[model samples]
Target: MDEITEGTSQVDCDILVIGGGTAGPMAAYRAKKKNPNAKVILLEKANVKRSGAISMGMDGLNNAVIPGHSTPEQYVKEITVANDGIVDQAAVYKYAQNCYEIIQELDGFGIRFQKDENGDFDVKKVHHIGTYVLPMPNGDTVKKALYRQLKRARLLISNRYMATRLLTGKDGRIAGAIAVNTRNAEFLVVRAKAVILCMGAAGRLGLPTSGYLFGTYENAANSGDGYAMAYHAGAGLANLECFQINPLIKDYNGPACAYVAGPFGGYTANNEGMRFIECDYWSGQMMQEFYNELQSGKGPVFLKLNHLADETIGEIETILHEVERPTRGRFQVNRNNDYRHGMIEMHISEIGFCSGHSASGVYVDDNACTTVQGLYAAGDMASVPHNYMLGAFTNGAVAGEHAIDYVNEVDFADIDEDFIAAEKERVLAPTKRDDGIPPNQVEYKTRRLVNDYLQPPKVTRKMQLAQDRFAETRAVMENEMVARNAHELMRSLEVSSILDCADMAAFASLFRTESRWGLYHNRADFPERDNENWFCHSILSKDDAGQMTIKKKDVDPYIIPIEDEEKDAYDKQRIKAQA
Candidate 1:
């Protein structure tokens, strides 16, 4: 590794994996495994032991794609229908094909998945068309499992270093990345042959209705850093308007774990205590039905586990309280609520970009390769529909293996000193200001605007106004936002990322005139879905003049073609029994 001197801190590696969350550690592990001699470095904003989306751990695999349980073709088609047919089938197909492999690998790593009496993987039907949700009874230690593997791989791990930007070489390929220590405020320059980003999602882009900034469905730290870095590096981000809005525990702002509890006879119910949607699987159509039920005369939705047996409810509590958010039980107890006696109130989550649940992230091919050479993305940050946790692991392996091959073909590129100096100046500017806007205040205002204008049933005028307000907010972030310490500096940088995502969301929403993805990208003005011109993926990138540009990219021809009947399967998510 050729180290380039940039002040006091200089680090070099054969491959650099940013965001040591669900996908990142796996990527680092696989990169080292693929090329044992090459040095692989993993960077994280927090401890690798527990961070990102699965910080608490996953409830279950939303898309297992297990062999006997489901096929890649079937899994691909289900995701295609779920996303309103605007997905790159190849990308989803790749995830489907390889995810099962990772599930078994995780099993070897000591992460347990629930199995049947016959010793078969217990897969449940949650989607409109497939049985993919695999419960993890002891999944709270998923991060621990990954951490063990990362340690065994003997890779370098840097914790509390938040990567802010991707450094490009003279040839315009990924050379390395720039980051800062959230603990000490020391700037870091990582020079590498290849870089992989697994920065989770833009979870903090929208303020939760609870009025708490940290109370988001996704990990609070995932404030669109990957999206911002990828965009600035000139990578294409797909379906920014197809935001991630989950049916979460109201006010508490965490998953209600319908995917885990649904099979145990738990269902989403309206105030009348009747099931509204047929499937609990999260999709745009499912959320639309959820939103409509809340708006309907029988308002306020609830996760109805009151009908379950005491034994079943006990089992549910064990899984819910122990895994995933873990705070669901505490939050419920504070309200004096129990699943056996009362239903848990549910609400639609704040809008943000997360390809793990929704189809909005940096575009990547089957191998996790982005448009920019030597730059790859996986996990919630990569554009693969309904990928969930298993997808992140599988895609991480793909990116890591491919990145090793990529680095072998290309030699290390020199880092430009001027570019490094400019980025350093920009990052440190917030701390330099004696008195300026606090990052939290700026974030709150920007996210409030996100909810006011960009949260869907979007309107042309509202989105237009959103653009104007976003521009002003971006200016505030660029000029006025202040950071007193390294932690505040992290927040300040995250605010910038959130602003970038806000701009992308507003511009992308306005660009796609037709409303699609059900409640996700619903335009009140254009209430109808226009497949004629809008069927293709809405790709966004920074133009030459540094303005956000949107263009329609043809969806890669489907490997597993969707039947006409199957296309509308997601559109009819509401149960006829409710009607």
Candidate 2:
């Protein structure tokens, strides 16, 4: 480990795993285990013990394919339909095939899962057509389990260091990355043979409805760092227009836990206490229905659990309160609303890019390799549609193990000192200024523009205006944004990432030209799905001339074929009225 100082410092490692969240730890652990002699460093902007999306832990596996309950083929087809057939089935299939082993490994790490009396893994139905949800009653301690594995594997962990940019070699392969200490603003250059990015999602791209900046559905720290880094590194990002929008608690902005509660006789209902959608699975179609309900006279949807028996409600509360967003229980109590007597109010979440819940992320193949050489992306940041936490683990392991093979065949690329110097100057510029626009103001305005112009039910003119406004916001961030200290500097840097994502979101949404993923890319002018003109994956990247470009990449042919009859499964989420 290199000593920390006021000046720039450098460290060399065989592999550098960015983001200590769900995927990054698994990636680093697998890399180190593959070759005990290799020096693998897991870099996190926050402490490994409590960081990323699952910092407090998750409630359950959103897409678990345990043997008896579900098969990899079934899971692949389900995700394919859910994503509107614009999926890389191969990538989804790979995650499903390997996820069972990853679960067993996590179980070995002392993470507990809900199992039946026969010692069989307890699986429940949450999706529209499959049984995939596997609960973790004691899931709040998940991060602790991962921390233990990382230490036992002897992988070096670096906390409080946020990477700003990727360092590409002369040959355009990944050379290293440049990061800054969030505490002291110290610039540190990490040179590595390979790099794996698992930096969650562009969660903070949209401002919460509550007017709180940090109150987002995804972790607040996941401010599109990986998305920005990959774009600058010249990697193609897939389906940026297919944004992540969830049905969350109103004002509180936490998950309503439909997966956990739906299996226990809880459901999403209108004010009339009538169920609207047939399934609780989160898809764009489902969100479209949710948005419609909010717009209809039957407005203000609720997660209704008041009809269930006392014991069932108690079990639901125990799981929902103890894991995932534990603060959810407290929030309900603050409102004086109990599940036994009343329903939890729900609303549509603000839009952001996330492959974990939706299908917008850095493009990667089945093996987790990105378009750039020696660079791999997994977790929510990577483009495996609807790949929840278990997908993060499986893909992280794949990236880590594959990177080892690549590192063995190559030598360390030369680091350009001039590039590092330039980045250091750019990163530290805000601190040098005595007074200017605060980062919070710029971020607030940028995200406000995101909601105003880029939020779905998208209009072309508004999206065009979004580009103009974001450019202005970027100018403010670059020229006038000021930071009083290192912490403020970190926030300032995050503003840049958020702006990049906001730009990509607008650009990709306009390029698609059709309303494909329901509300995710719903163009008001082009209000219908057009498979004839736009049926491929929309790829967004930074072109050679240093400009953002959009192009179409053909979706991979499905290995587990989907019949025409099954392709419209998700489109039928709204329940039909009986005579």
Candidate 3:
């Protein structure tokens, strides 16, 4: 092997938006629109033109807060109920209020939303209440539309750089970030007045049952970078115990897309083709029911689309195959299964953290401001429950707009030399080692352990055991993991982040004693929702000693109060069998 050459580069920007996926681009674009003269940089690990969660593009807005469809208050109530009442209503409401504007703005940018014959928005109900699901039959071009708008905004674009750690100033505020060029192995020291973390979810933390690392429900690139970065930088992440386990196309590992199919009369069913759940909304409660049915000797579950008319089936195929994950059609064809004749097999995805579908992410307020000064987060990585695509856009807008105002108030601070040197050594260590455990192997092992121990109906001893395995994985990170090249180096760094998320997941799960959020945090040992004691957010952060610390923070008072009778609206989602 040739001698590995190391290089360094520095950049100065007024605002830095990390992860160009659904949120980062919006953040960067909005920041530039807010202050065109202010230097803004949109940094992405992959091509900004196609990256993050919506890299292939999304099928529709899972949470579109449009007029005549849903009110922000009703949306808030639905999300709160969906998430089992452990949510920051303020943050959720903010997204609900502003998401419509972002949708209109995207529409103006040439992104299409399904409209009725009467010219009003064609919206559908996927949530237990309210019609929030807005389909985009041509939604595959969403990233392209955003890319066009991003170019129009003219923000500086840095692609193929994986952000490893956040840099803090002497004042303990976010000064910048440390990143490496994934292709060339060039180290980067980026100095920005404000940094918005929109690195999507920790999708790669767990191995897909297919044993394909990249075959995750979320984009393969989201390896918990934002969650780990924020935690190491002392940002509090909430409800990590509330893991992201979606009902996906078995083995293919993507959404069976209840939101898209349910409106067209497609529903999740057991082998008997009977609807078990009243609603197809992807919630913890809904998942709990799905899991129960699958485990209840009705072993294999499926998306029942065969019952639909030929025209409807054709429409579903057009939306499912053309938009979002286009690979699903090929997967079905390869398996010799057609939606018109057979039920699409469904399975529970391996555990991960995603605020898009379930509530587990870096805790942020309504303004998209994280607890850490000068650091902000949004999208699936930030804790705004069930924000989905539209939430990502609205929160990205919030982060970008607020960051501009923040940058105006703050000045560039000096980066700590010791910290920089330490981070550099940490990131470059894998490259220096000749051979040891490969990054893919380490990631796979850690994720396999996650499935073995942390998939819920959580047992106390099992989670404790998961912690022990995670500690072993941490040991592997320190002593065994190796990278042969820059791309491998990026994977190696991601393994460390995944380990951090795994440890946090186990720790947070153990801390929250009572079962809640349906299958998301269902503790087998304590099978009850203990609102009197455990109703607040379970926040995890690194302490002074660099140890993971768990604390209970009160859920902010609700702006829109739920009636006592309505609190259990999502509890009995299962449709009982007729005697």
Candidate 4:
């Protein structure tokens, strides 16, 4: 890292991966492996060793298409139908095709996976129609394995830097990005031939029920940076209205995680301790059912494990407590709740944008290439439709390898000084303020507005009203939000990203008039799925007049056709009682 002059640092690389999370590390590693001599820099707001969604480590692979258990074509069709037949099948298929290879690669890196006594991978069924979940009893060290590989690859790791915006060339190709150090508040300008945006999901866009600003289902650091940067860089966002809402532990804000407990006979039960929905997979339809259960006389949902034998409950507890949000066990213990004797209470999580769980994120093709030239995305931020952790590694590698080929043909583009100067002022304005509203206050207000106006069962007028309130919030943020130090500055910048995401969510919801993707975009004004009018992807992008514009992109023809019998399989998730 070289300093260009005072208050600014200039770094040059062949490829700039603007996230150190699940996808960015893999992307940087793969890019370097492909070219060897090419400079691949992985930038992170926090340390690479403990960051992103997997910082605490994952319990298992959510969408692993292992051989003999599930085929790529079957996995693709499952995701397509689960997403209400609105997915780009090619993209989902691409992830499925390469995910097994990625799993093998991770295994070689010393990450442990649950295997049967026959020495074969032990996969479980968690989705509506396919087996996908593969548990990792010792999954806590996943990041350690990745970190070892990243060091071996010799990729440049720049941590504690929060990327503010992307720097595009005159021809609108991605040149590089502008970032600010969260620790020292120093400005960084990286010039690269290509850039990959993997800044996780917009987790902090909605206020969690706990009232803690950082208490979110996704990592708190993932404050919609990638989505905001890509939008400003002229990239189209897909299905922003298809928000990610999970059934999490009430007040704790961590997942009840049916994927972990479902295979061992754990289920979501209403107040009566009886199962309602047939499946526990995190889909829009499944969430709709969960929401409906909460609205009914049942009122509350719980992870029903008390019915299981003590031995079975112990196995589930060992996996759940030791990995992927270890705090869940502690939170439970603090409440005097034990899996063997009592059920873990569950609640619907606050809304956010995440393609890792639902299908709303920056638009990308099968190759992980975004609409903008030289710009790519993967993981939660990219629209690959229910592409959990495995998709991140698979698509990250795809983005990296393809970017190497792209950079081989293109030269580094020049960034404009005027743009950099304008960005510097915009970024530093809060720090220079003598006194104004604090970042947390503004963030709370902004997210509170999100919960108030944007939590779906979607109404047309409320969504329109959300845009107006968001506009007012944006104005207040610009004028009055102040940060006293470098740390506060990071939070201030995140508020801007959160507001940008909130606005996009409302705009996209309003753009599509028909109800689709279950509770995700269940428009009350138009209460039916209008496949004839709204089957296409609703794309959100910045127009030439510098305004957010909505357009429809037709779904790509499915290479693996979904039969009529399978199209509505998810709609039948509710277990109907016999007459």
Candidate 5:
């Protein structure tokens, strides 16, 4: 706690991008690309070899790079429909327009796509926006391709870095950030005029039992890091209640669950072998229709069908290096291909298991500006509210371009020496200080509290208890926290995020007052959708400490004049060309 201190090296730049994952890289790339003279640097906690969700070269770039049965308009339509009237239609159209470009951009960076037996591009069939399957490619390849360009640009990469707190200028605008280099235990003060927070959502705020869909079996690294930093800085967070859970798997590392497809019609079952969708609660019948064949006692072993053809196998071989073994005196793909070989046997459901997409995050204007001055968020860190995963790439690109434009217009200055020194002194002071509650301990306690009492489900009693308990835990943490240095300061911040965001997430969950959606959040108290009580957005902010103040925002339902349908179609076609 008090023993840990913040890093001390001070360096100023034009733009400081956080979280070297998805949006982070594209932001860094676009920033520098737009402004050739701008000094750009990306501060990544992880290394160039392993940053971004695309690092492994197999993340399945779902924006649809290949031609399928559907057109770009169809893609946009699917996303809008699946999102259930909550998607940013404009953003969807924008992303859909650039979907091919994103893939082409990645390929230009040396990421090889799976080719047909005749050495041409190939496509794979995947689940569509909802019930059907659509063709897409592996996503990990996308990450590797981005890495290639980043290396070409010589973007500054600070690996093994853990940023604990954001630095602000005299005007209270987000100026830069301070972090620790875990490898050598040194301090780094990154000063930038513009900061983009790409940190993921609430996996870090809940109990160990709480998890993302594909990430449920594996521990999550997203501590709502971006959410925490933005919230305290006056950013509004929306739709925090929309946490998606993939109930298909108990673990990503355990035995495959191929049998679920049998009893549940075409859908897979949980370990209980019961078609959970059969419960009386659901009225829409979307999930239940999927449950029939897989839930039937005599279901087929759809798991054994091999989906990864030769091209996919080759792509797998090219992307995974370290995980590969030697074949013919040359290393080939070293991966869980054994699992794929058995995907049809039992793990057929694994294909549908990754539910941790960012449905909600920091609220930003159409321009991608957050509530805080000189700070902006885009990509997954910002809330699409009504959009799904298809938007992350296009959104990242848009945000990157916006940040570059923003930096050009803002009046910039050098790094504040006083702030850096004070941070340095604060970090150094911890070594001289004595015992205090550790950041890890504060974080652990807070997560345990939220995971136990404050899930997405909003019951009256549970919400009140969670609200009070979250407040209590935050008070205890703040009081017990003893930090004279930078390291200790960060520990305090990490704990602060969980405690503060727990109330934020809970408030949003309670205000919604319905279990209208979410595979995991079933509210017994609010049994039905009370659109009257819950139609508006539930937004939360902080007044220092972790206390939550809730506000309601008007829902702007989309409208298009019926007679102008032909004109709208022409406009859409035009927008597609520009995008």
Candidate 6:
């Protein structure tokens, strides 16, 4: 049990939730629901006004239900396959089984989804399939809905609040957290019995990929903050190495972030301008399940054109204009590199965004509880279920429910205010005064390293040299990385950022020993998916001293029964998915 000391000026609460996004709020909301007397607080780095990565208007739940074709079992099966068989099976099942309840719970609130003429939930409209997920809405609708619930529950919600680190009581229990109100520049020390980390993955943060080079959805502020704080606070983390990359993002031109910007579309064009498909019908060549097309010139490819002036161009124009952000990192691409010296902007059409959506986070058992006491994680930050809409909500709800249960079990006691005050001063230390190097400068260099060294589908000997150079350059930056205020804090963050994710990624890359599918990780040295020795999930963990170690957690296909003769069924289902 945790309690705040009397006259503890700045600290408050029974549970402190980092992130007011999808999973964080649910955890906070559910925590309060279980213990009415418990004080719950949610902190968001940005506004609670919108869902960060996937947009706020449409929470795209995977709605894959057919008459008798799909079940939770089938969905789980497909999910594991889609993830390349490295998922936590129990966690997936728990989430899959209870996904509908989460959606129904959401619907019970004011959040609405599309429906058919029969007046049933029109989930399929939001997602391509409906078996596992609710075909959820975006952050605008989904986040606001969650916010409404958070408000109704009276859980304290703070926007633009940055969680500096997880706070542990003298008893070694994770009692709460330390944070800064980014807007007011004030330190906040929250003492709680439990803490939930719901920040998404380290993948989309311009991690070594086309997102850095081509501008695919990099949420800069996120910067693996949750993962860093957790690691710093002695929280056991797993799968830090496996941040999923989007295949479509790689194949697209212009800002890669626009890949998932509008509706799910994949318009792939080759150097010679040819269309490629997940399952190409024009010929009989089998579409490689997941391969790197960026350098191989064969992985999943999306086309880039130079105009969109047709009759129905209005729709794409509307979405594109609204969501388009300028490209910055590696490709410094304006309207020229993609179209070539101002040839004219192109509207990617026909194809849709494909999934390379697995990511890494905290290792949780069936209950989403990390090895650390009184610590919980959900969504991308919590390990399990990487980058899909349906998966996020499903697992998020499970973690939320379990977190509340954990919160209620703990008895209330007094928390130490002195520790919190000290934490606040530490967080304010960086900002109270500026480290010489701007956070962006360090980030840009890091992004370049990722762009050159990590970005793959293996180019050539030159790229290998580039990678070596990247390591050397990054080492210097980290060695000499200096900071003053927030920028200084960020410099330290960047240093940890590379090691935090890179250690995991580097180890995972080394162990897999082969470039399996094109999900960000690529080994030019070994360019093939070696199923015999390495067809497994790349599991990573940090020890008490923050040393990263990687292991292979193989997927046992036997958990869900399969007919010996029905192997074709698996292939068929996969084919349908690719289609």
**Candidate that would win on lDDT:** 2
Candidate 5's C-alpha lDDT?
0.54
List residue ranges in candidate 3 displaced over 4 A: 1-4
List model 5 lDDT by residue over 1-579, tens digit each: 224433457787888878786677777887888887887878776665665444443423334534543455665555443433444445555665675676677667665555667865554433332221222244434566677777877777777676766776667677788777654447887878888776644545554432332232212445556777677666777667665332232223221221111212233323333233322111112232223334555343232223446554444433322221112112112333442343322211211101224256787665566777778776666866332233555566677788888787776544567766765554444344467666666767766667667653446688778888877776766455655554445455556656766777677777666665433334668776565766565567775565667677764543311233322221111112223
Model 6 CA deviation exceeding 4 Å by range: 1-9, 63-69, 122-140, 169-172, 183-185, 203-216, 247-275, 279-356, 411-435, 458-499, 554-558, 562-579
lDDT string, candidate 6, 501-548, tens digits: 543444445555665434444566776656798766655566656575
Judged by lDDT relative to the true structure, which candidate is superior, 3 or 5?
3
lDDT of candidate 1 over 248-302, digit per residue (tens): 8899988887887888999999998998787888888889999999999987999
What is residue 574's positional error in candidate 3, in angstroms? 0.9
Q: Write the per-residue lDDT of candidate 4 for residues 1-579, one digit (tens) a residue.
A: 322223898989899998998999999999999899998999999999999999978999989999999999999899999988998888888888899999999999999899999999999998888998999877899999999999998888999999999999999999899999887789999999999999999999989999998999999999999999999999999999999999999999898779988999999999989999989998888889999999899868999999999999988888888888988889988999999888888999999999999999999999999999999999999999988898888999999999989999999998998999999999988888889999998899989989988898988888788888888888889998888788888899999999999999999999999888888998888889998998899999998888999999999988999999989999887889868
Clashes of each: 0, 0, 0, 0, 42, 55
> How accurate locally is residue 99 in candidate 5, as Cα lDDT from 0 to 100?
58
lDDT of each: 0.89, 0.92, 0.90, 0.91, 0.54, 0.52
> TM-scores of the models, in the given order?
0.97, 0.99, 0.98, 0.98, 0.73, 0.74
lDDT score, candidate 1, position 252: 91
User: If both were scored by TM-score, which would come out higher, candidate 2 or candidate 6?
Assistant: 2
Sort order, lDDT high to low: 2, 4, 3, 1, 5, 6
Off by over 4 Å in 2: 1-5
> For each candidate, C-alpha RMSD in Å?
2.7, 1.7, 1.3, 1.9, 8.6, 7.2
